[model samples]
Target: MLLGIFIAASSAGWAIAQGAALRVPDVPYEPTPHNVVAQMLRLAQVREGDVVYDLGCGDGRIVIAAVRERGTRGVCVDIDPQRIRESRANAAAAAVAERIRFLEQDLFTTEIREATVVMLFLWPEVNLKLRPKLWRELRPGTRVVSYVHDMGDWKPQRTMTVQGRYGPRPLYLWTIGSAPDR
Candidate 1:
């Protein structure tokens, strides 16, 4: 999970003194630990030629790691511009910026159909809300990995416990179209 405070705003948007409306993020940023990031990539079985999308990517660690360690191209999506900047800087430092695209927009609105693997470290409700989009957009056999959250009623292909910053955390993996539609 990436770390940051997100102020929830109306769908219509919130206006400041400048009269410009801002679309607030649905979740806060709490970066996934480095160890968990490694496990997520392992669970997803990312490899070369794979396109990895990390929704709510904080500091772009997951995508950066995949690009560096697994030779995969990646996209980092975040609703907050600050987080996007941090991701870009981190990716640049990791020397994988050229292989990663950073998008400063809502994850739900981002185009992810091309992703061969999707990584998420979001809230439980957000994960549930994102399920249909994953099912509808991702092609068959596309792997979806989530850290510390499960899509309710959607059985995962695999689940593992990994040592995290706090303690052991659960990671989940689901291959698109592998199980019955929920």
Candidate 2:
């Protein structure tokens, strides 16, 4: 009976493993340039005194821009220690170090409960994994802005296509209300 139970447990564990969702590997990090930053800011509608959070914040460009240009406070999160160091340097260089906090953490584990605006540049799978977290934490009117990717099964409140130095860039904006009709 014990041997049979062990076999059944092993089979069940294997089945659960097969049913688990897998996160795609991290994408190559790229900074949003100044022109793209402008469009994101426009779409996010960030105002002074608002707190912004940037998940997978690569090089701290978005956080730096938010604090420096919009007079808002920001939290910048990145899993890579090297990227965190780079973001610190970038924030200091931009003279917004006092207003932005750089955190070295996995994006899936970081908390943005106090944020009034959230920025994202992650892949679709990462976004999907984070959707429920955002819905649970963000206040009803808080804004979410994404670059290059959209949350599957959620419709954006606003969409903009801006012509940047590299080419046209797509920006998506959503609020933390009901999930958009799939």
Candidate 3:
């Protein structure tokens, strides 16, 4: 009876997931808030010509900001096709469409080795699972910035409290090779 209930729940979830490709209940879309974007960008330390990758980039605000403000090229990855479309539109509106690429792909499986800077605003568990990948894939000098969450077992090189119009936000910055144990 327990096994039957488990299967029923699993089937229901799959059906719901298929019905909502743009957003699953557990995976609601959260666009980067303006204040958080400012904080994360600062933490990213993005420079001209930098290749920035934003995992789970909802609406592409961070990628668009990077290209527009810092002269950086960016790749924005999200599992939702709707988000990819939104990001592309946002980039075009920001006039950084040519500098940013929006991709609909799993963040974990995507290649980020070429990134000079990577940004994320994801669940803590997601970051934790991605820790080893970041360490293994990113170059020594690569900069990683996270909004509201920290990479597991990896201590940030710098942290800042960003006060915004809405509220106070904490941004964490990490460098790949500097503190492996963090």
Candidate 4:
């Protein structure tokens, strides 16, 4: 009976044991350049009273910077435990750990309804797959920003090119419920 239960849970994409991820991450860990992070914050117009959520947060730089620079609270969600640990350490080093919460779990399953701004640095397909969840969970007027990828068929309200480690990378911004039909 226990083995059957385990099989059922695993088939549904649940982690088989503690410390394991519910599923493999959609992309590898790649830190966004500091310049791009700054631009993301600027483009998002992050400010006090805002609750920022960095989906698939790597090293927690985005959330850390948001909390430190804008006095906003943040949530860092990553499937990788290592990334979560790194994010926590980085947040502590930046002295903004109290303002940031780290969740070591799948970004797909993380609750983001409280966020006023959502940051994404994931792959194109991942962004596409995550679009509906963002649209459904986030409140109206919430800002969604993506680096290096754009959500398909959902036009961004604003787009800008920012210099990244590899050269110019595109940043996209969309306000939930403000755009026309997808």
Candidate 5:
């Protein structure tokens, strides 16, 4: 029974991703757990000097938190215009509007070369879709943090289950050039 439950839970994210794969839209706007948000920032080792990018940013919570907690500057990119507007408002509410750029742009087309740390709460397929982009665009040593999905075939440098809003959830971290890009 335990194994069955485990298998079901593990496959659910992928099933959802496949359902949404045709569009590859932003991972459903379920906000990352607040605890997980800080954990993601910490895992990425965010610093004031780091230029971060939160792809598929929803409500801009992650970027706002990064600026508020890490004193870092970042850009929030979400394909949804509504999310972009909400992010801007959230940034203002958090008093970090000037430190962040809100772009209502497709994640795939956005330029992420300037980022030293990138955060995501996207799906497995989206991560796979973005993996090559991350390798081709991000500079060596750039850190990438994904809340749940693992970039398929590119094993993460680190993976751990951390406390979240409901329970423990896996957070994956990979540093660009940690190994020669295959």
Candidate 6:
């Protein structure tokens, strides 16, 4: 019955019944508009030699874009293997497969300390949950940019509003050292 499906479980309770080990706590996929994506990368100042990590990377657009636009390398992490496969296909189509590493793993546990820039478009609660990891792991001056949701309580260094196909959307940016230590 429901055994085959990995029901979205809460962080507090991980109910394992039939061995479908999947825990996705983020929001549904909503691709950041291309214009917004450009603005996000620009805000982070992604340049050549930079390593960008996209947490909960849906289709790997951010990673592909970073490599395609600025010759930077990128790592995209997603819990969904289908998304990882799609990411690989998209990277190949974008002609930047060599510059991207696609991983089908949990966003909260993946090691991204080497990232110079991290992009996100997750839900508000997930944003808050990820704040500590970003603060502790990312190096000082490492740029973290979010498409819509923001890290709660930890203020962004800069915030901007962009007009997309769906109208105005808020974007947030935070540098690692700007926030007080946990």
Query: How do all models score by TM-score?
Result: 0.87, 0.81, 0.82, 0.87, 0.83, 0.85
Question: Model 1 clash pairs?
Answer: 1-30, 1-31, 1-32, 2-29, 2-30, 2-31, 3-29, 3-30
lDDT of 4 by residue, 89-172 (tens): 999999999999899888888999999999999999999999999988888899999999999999999999999888888999
Per-residue error for 91 in candidate 4, Å, reads 0.7
Off by over 4 Å in 1: 1-21, 178-180
Report lDDT per candidate: 0.88, 0.83, 0.82, 0.92, 0.86, 0.85
Positional deviation of 37 in candidate 1, in angstroms?
0.6
Over 1-182, each residue of candidate 2 has an lDDT whose tens digit, in order, gives 99999998997787567642133227567877778887788888898988989898889888888899899999998876667788999898888898988887877788788999999988888889898889887887899999978898788988888775578877899988754333
After the best TM-score superposition of candidate 1, give how far the Cα of residue 44 lies from its true spot, in angstroms.
0.8
Worst 10 residues of 4 by lDDT: 13-22
Cα lDDT tens digits for candidate 5, 53-144: 99999899998998998899999998766688889999999999999988778899999999999998888888888888999999989999
Which of candidates 1 and 4 is the stronger one according to lDDT? 4
Highest lDDT, which number? 4
- Worst window of 10 by summed lDDT in candidate 2: 18-27
The CA-based lDDT of model 6 is what?
0.85
lDDT of 5: 0.86
C-alpha RMSD values across all candidates: 6.9, 7.9, 4.1, 4.0, 10.4, 5.3
Candidate 1 structure lDDT: 0.88
Residue-wise lDDT of candidate 6 within 105-178, one digit each (tens)? 88889998999999999888988888888888898889999987878777788999998678898899888885
- Best model number under TM-score: 4
**Candidate order, lDDT descending:** 4, 1, 5, 6, 2, 3
Instruction: Give stretches of model 5 more than 4 Å off.
Output: 1-26
Instruction: Give the runs in model 4 whose Cα sits over 4 Å from its true position.
Output: 1-22, 178-180
